[model samples]
Target: MFNDRPFPVDAFPKIIRNAIYEVEQHTQAPQGLIAASVLGVISLACQNRIDVCRLNNLRSPVSLFLLTLAESGERKSTVDKLLMKPLYQLEENLFEKYTHDLTIWKNDEAIFNIEKKALMLKLKSDIQRNKDYFATNEKLKDLLQSPPKAPVRFKLIFNDATPAAIKDHLCGYWRSVGIMSDEAGAIFNGYTLNELPFINKMWDGATFSVERKSEPEKLIRNARLTLALMVQPDVFKGYLQRKGEAAKGIGFFARCLICQPDSTQGSRKISSPVVSSEHLPVFHQRLMEIVNDNITLDNKNDRLCLRFSLEAENRWIEFYNKVESDMGFFGSLSNCKDYASKVAENMARVASLLHYFNGNDGDIPLSAIEDAVKITTWYVNEYIHLFSKPNEFTLAITEGDELYWWIKNHCNRHVVPYITKNTILQYGPNKFRNRSKANELLNMLQSQNKILIGKRGKTTLIAIANLKPAI
Candidate 1:
């Protein structure tokens, strides 16, 4: 029961949809990759500035955790680079400002240290001589109070960072950040995944204390973080093979919106026209506007809370109940109950992102929630397709379906009326490339009347039953 539906690109706002379309035309990348990249950028920009209010009055950050699984030459990096241009430019500008500010602060800090040393000497001498030391003590107190303040270092994105480094940055510098990478082998294979509990807490937006033996304990409060990683299919499967049980036990994968799309490798043409420079700049401008607004606020942690309208709330509750029911013992989503449980909240988070990114100021409308549901439902099905274990009958159906598609595609491409069984056994899907397996699936399809098996001059030929000729 692998429901491999295409991603719902039309559910996105116009700005996002246009960008995805233009990028797909230019790069010929899978729409799933482009959509994931666009959503990652939206999460980075909106996570710090907006919060979604659930029906229970509880507020949650709109940050998202995305995992994209593709093959090696799928152009994942190219898609990411195109969408992340604004963030790169912002980081460069912020780094320059920080460097300038650091220089001035260093000189002021030197002068303050010298003055403090001299004042301490004078105060000690006056105390020993029993002279009036009250005025000197007061002067020293004033000097300590007026010591130079260090400027805050503004950084928005990190590629490969340890859990400790991430905690330090959020606690000591900016309260909002994103950990994004085109190749995330370091993150999945390193110490970051080892600390699942820490990452889970950050995703929950919970207040937690990080205690160090050599320094004071740092408290992380009202901090926001977005994690988006793109890795090859084999690497991700290896991670699951090693730590699948632990990850499920802690509900780690339950927090992620994972996508693994069919590759578009051979279909991309070198002569494809270059993308019009129009759509991406609009996307970049909108992203910069939101980021700049977040930067200029007096308190970075203060977020604008968005609530659902009455109609939207009713729709949300209905969706919640539907998901809950589907997690029953015999329901479609019963295998992945953890993911099903969290899908509603993820839907709300997505709706909030859509609402805010479109510059809507009022409560989240029904249309946004409806659109979010369509997108999130696709993710729900994708999760099941990737992670769920199918019974024997299900596996047979899946294999038969794959073989059917292969035969149909081969016929259409080569303009052949029938395919030899030997050709299928040689070039079909790997699962059915053997003699015994090929016969088993071919017989099954013939019984279903979806394909015909016949012989031409002592050679077995396979043809798609009633497949219309190409126009």
Candidate 2:
């Protein structure tokens, strides 16, 4: 909804004209009533923007963006209307959508789809429009060039989250498939999958200063294949060694999908890795379902995505010829990155791999992922839980739910910005509620030895203590 900053187009004029008429409507009422009526008029006029864009499914936050761009009005009534009306409508819409379906297991494709298109269009257009800025400003355009073999940050919570019991009831709900254990609370660990095609798309978008472009996709493929083979070496590997074509083809697809060297960036805008299985039919079916869901709802964020992408395949080939090319290229892919965000990202991806290899996926099942998010929610009620302050003195790592998990706990009351995958600002400490607390947290971080860096719209702090050469 923003491009670091946004440029208001037509919405500016509408606010100006409406303010004049609002003052006229409230002349006769008493001072209190007049004040309230005038406020109401301005608010209503500004909100009629749903009519202006004709987008019924507009997100609550986007309206605020448009309103911010509204011209300042002189009359108190007009000003108040412009200020508060959009917010009111936004609250109304959000309340209706959340309450009816906030239950554990329900297909949220409807909401997801509406939100996806709105965001994707906004994001894509912004990138396309600013092509010139990126071209001229060498520094800005450089942001899109992904490093080799980037890791996917996977956040999975594994308490008592199970899907089989809730499958019939939930849409986006992920439940544990087999392990029916009360001991488990819920799991929410962030994973970073590699990006394949997106790398190509971004490279294509960039000035093409990259070393190798055409064959980049090939190296990208080998990287994904290496990872998939690594994903389940004992069981799935022996099978893939024999299957030949399907193995190669699916390997290629997986290579392209996961946004990792071993990962394939699948057709869906949603981020998920291709896991090998003896049950191809079931896997295929799930793949189609996920793709369909992604098509229907994938928004600007791709929702949450891995910055990692397959090095263009062709580039991989040259790299192989020049390099060891053994272990199927794991060394080439695991190279530690210099970028600040990518540094932590590599670790998160490795963490997901640890959880995934532990039979957590099939054991826990997919539906529980969202359920696992509760751990993050509970994390914010106070602090100093198991995950809280783990690396505070060391890496300065603070525990909490990711932004989505945080916002969702509030039923996405308003859009909460994310800083990387795991951290976010909780809504509670706003000016009206625990303001001092929020300030204290922010000020404390700002005053610390480390600096905070934001990525994908969220603030992330770097702990000097966490620094280590690539593990």
Candidate 3:
């Protein structure tokens, strides 16, 4: 059974919950969309500074990959802009500093080049005159060895980039970055998704070599990347239609926390006063604090590793076993075992994020783990709802019910002995627009004696077998 439930907003930390609520009240977007945007920011802010220790004593980055599916006009961009304010502010500050540092570095490099040329000339003249050249040679060596270092330009967010560009940035510039977009057409529709395998390695925090044609092979290690894409349903569907099998085969989608929230398009009214002013400032302030702290840590190449308490470890083990059992042949999640297998790890990662964001120290507590489970369980059901395939019998019954209701409503309103098949195909349910599916449903309904099918002068007609009209 696939369940479509509301997001478990209360399960999040108070800071995160406040931000989600503020965004929801202001934008009136789906709660899930707001929550996803908030979580993406948290992942970006925390990935560089924190690592989590699993039960096996293995360390993993607290990064996350979130994929949100919604229709157009869902206010995804609005919510993301509100949530990502801190990150944008941080990037602006970094760009300003980089501009100043780059100017100084360029001047230093020019001076070093001028001095080195003078030293080389002195060494050549000394050598030609058969004078003592050791002093000039030593000067040249010292100057060459002491060239000014280039400043690191810290960029934290990327909207559109290829895998090669991503690796280059990580290898040369910043070790932590996020790839986020509210409208993700370029990510899914362009060539970015062709490197799913490489992206998968980034999510796993695994080291891999980037072999280049002209440059040396760059080994990408200890690099952290967070992916958060909010795309409309049709774009994602097209990607799935074309490359879903390959993506699944490589376990790329398994690492994602995917959701398709119900759209809140028409119900959003503009009656209430904006209240995000109350909560979003606090959220943004705290986020900037975290990001600034992480920037310091990143420069020092230091990270804080969090571990679970004894009680929390036991609870996590139990939860892991439960998720693993659910992937068995007779279990509810058997259809999506790939996602099921990783849900527990993702739960742990979420717990780590919550724990760190709340300024908790020492070990992660049981309460955080419990809260994370509530959130991840909802995501598990969402994955099944979006990806699970229905059997023929079940699909037939579902579509049959839809067709029956449309026919019953149409017949009750019109005082006609019969309705033409053309009318049903044209004005009926969209799913039954195909002639073959409509004919199959008509035959099934006729066999059940629910409808009578006949011909009226070259037109096929359908009538309710026992019809009644309400007064």
Q: All candidates' lDDT scores?
A: 0.84, 0.24, 0.82
Provide the global lDDT of candidate 2 against the true structure: 0.24
Q: Pick by TM-score: which candidate is best?
A: 1
lDDT of 1 at 339: 92
lDDT by residue (tens digit), candidate 2, 334-449: 22111111222122222222222222332222222222222111211111221123242111223122211222222222232222212223322122124454445444544652
Which pairs clash in model 3? none
- CA displacement after TM-score superposition, residue 120 of candidate 3 (Å): 1.4
Q: TM-scores of the models, in the given order?
A: 0.85, 0.17, 0.83
**How many clashes in each candidate?**
0, 88, 0
lDDT by residue (tens digit), candidate 3, 55-141: 767788889999998767788888988889768877899999999999999999999999999999999899899999998899899
lDDT at position 457, candidate 2: 38
Model 3 lowest lDDT segment of ten: 389-398
What digit string (tens of lDDT, one per residue) describes model 1 on residues 188-285? Answer: 88876678887777778988788899999999988888989999766786787788779988998999998776556534667745557798889888
